[model samples]
Target chain A: MKERKSEGNEVKVRWYGYIVLVIAILFFSGVFTAFEGPLKALDFTNLAGDFGKLGTLEEGAGSLASNFRGTGGAGAKDAWMFAMTLFPTVMFALGVVKVVEYLDGLKAAQKLLTPLLRPLMGLPGISGLTLIASLQSADAGASMLNTLAEEGEITEKEKNIFAAFQFSGGGTLTNYLSSCAALFAFMTVPILVPLAVVIAFKIVGANLMRIYLNKVCKQ
Target chain B: MDKKVTPKKTVVDAFVEGARNGFGISANSMAPNVMFAFVLIQILNLTGLSDILGVIFQPVMGIFGLPGVAATVLIASFLSMGGGVGVAASLYSSGLINGTHISIMIPAIMLMGALLQYMGRILGTANVDNKYYPQLFAICFINAILSMFVMRLIVSL
Candidate 1:
């Protein structure tokens, strides 16, 4: 009876610890913090801020209206671009996944990937497809994981681990080319060097999550 | 001797079904996510909340050897990479930031960009439990910071 009581106390302490951690993260990331000054209130003098000029909160309403209309200014253009680029790819990739399923290609791929993934990331072979897709598109990779889980191809634990991997540096290749590459074009440092560094560390982070999930949330 | 064979779907049928399933997944999972995130990010972008965030995070950004003003670019990224790219390009053109600074910033930006949208759209569609979102963000942010340090060290070397 005493031992049971102590164990219960330990769980409570751990639970409280988690809550504290979450709260700290929120605070440090500026959930409670706000800047003081004109900058604090978004600048509306500029064209970007013109949208803000329509009315104090009107820009927000406009944004919502634009979303429904599937249109907007620059920001909406970008979002549309994202959808245009990714939606087709996702659509095509899903077809490919379908064909692969019929051909039993996933199993063959899994067999090939098992040695590498299981040993390094503690994930199943099927997760290899998701990883590869993640290089090009994180959404595709994540969606695939969802599909796999729903289909009973991977357990919940494996899904979580794979999700960790995707989250660490999702859209590895695409993002590098699109964002980092441009940012580095004029930089003195070689582009590949930083790119490689981010990838390596992202993998490290994914591994960290894998370890934690496996040990702590193994259920 | 007698042989038995199971009927199989024709290639065309398989392809059609695959396309259907693909579209279904995209529509059901990714479309709404994209729409919702687009709306939220649009609001944030137009309002310049991201700029406010930039000012607030200047000190922390300085730790990465980036100019405090670079927080603007970082904040813009949270809404969309294109905006982030635009901010970065302008900064680069104006000679506010250089290659070395960019090296550190790029990795960090990639980690934290598109926060609400990426979380709601990608991970949300995957049904990643909400409980893990904070943990995941924390892990990714830490990883970016670590990468920034490494990149900074390498560039300085």
Candidate 2:
């Protein structure tokens, strides 16, 4: 009974520590944004010019009166171009994950991650794979958790932790590309800082819930 | 009456079956999610909520080594995944932020996902007991706040 109380206290201390850390970071982020104002404004004008060029290309295509024109218009073509450029990388990542799974490489991964996870996050070893899987695809990671639950590879408590991990980590290739591409174009400090803040909050938020749920909820 | 043989299920059938059994969550949820995303975007645009959120987060955003207006993009990211991307694209096209800012924001947005509401569906599908859901959510909220802080620290250093 005494040990349990100490454990509970430890969790509380950790939780508060995280909270304080987050607040401090936000305060600092605000200062950083203030410092970056002028450069960001300059970048904004450059971005407008770049977008104008893209618009001109679209207008040029619209002026063309060929039989095969509309379907192959600049906007449509650009979208396709973007897709083609990104798809190969996604496919390659997927293929690598698939091959690894087929060879039971995940089991080895799980074994390796177990020690670190328990101490750092209170997550079980097998959950390491689920966490990694989530980084690639939310649906795939969730499905993996479901499979593990069905197969009894992890307990219900562990599954909840995995769920929280997924909640925190699940973002696909497309998300990364678009967000990055947009921010890169502008060089605006204002636009970049908050995006970073919220994302960090979400990740930490999800993980903290995982830890909390593990402790308070019954298995 | 003579001998009969059973045909094997095709790959597609097997695949469908696997998805059905494995996911367990309703595919129909996508419709609501998409619809909500649209509604959220419209509201943000109509009310100029994006700008407000940006202003609100500005002070806190400084430590993270990002600009104040980034809050708008972050809010967009939260309302709809695609909307956030659209905001990013527009910002990029407008030349508001640089490659480094973009790099920093990208990971942050990816880390956040569609947090609050989406988490409900996720936890629901996971069949997490209702009693713990609220507490878990609280923790998630706190975690997100902390994640922002950590990202700021990393970028600043």
lDDT of each: 0.59, 0.48
lDDT for each residue of candidate 1 in A57-137, tens digit (9 for 90 to 100): 444454433222233234435444444433444444345444444554433433444568777877766566676566557
| CAPRI-style grade of the A/B interface in model 2 | incorrect
Docking class of 1: incorrect
Error of model 1, residue B98, in angstroms: 1.5
Interface RMSD, all models, one decimal each? 9.1, 9.7
Error of 1 at A88 (Å): 20
Cα shift from native, residue B79, model 2 (Å): 3.4
Best DockQ goes to which candidate? 1
* Candidate 1 C-alpha error for residue A186, in Å: 1.7
Write candidate 1's Cα lDDT for B27-57 as tens digits: 5644443444445445645697645765777
Tell me the lDDT of model 1 at B34. 44
lDDT, candidate 2, B43-71, per-residue tens: 55468775676577778766666566566
Q: How high is the lDDT of residue B145 in model 2?
A: 48
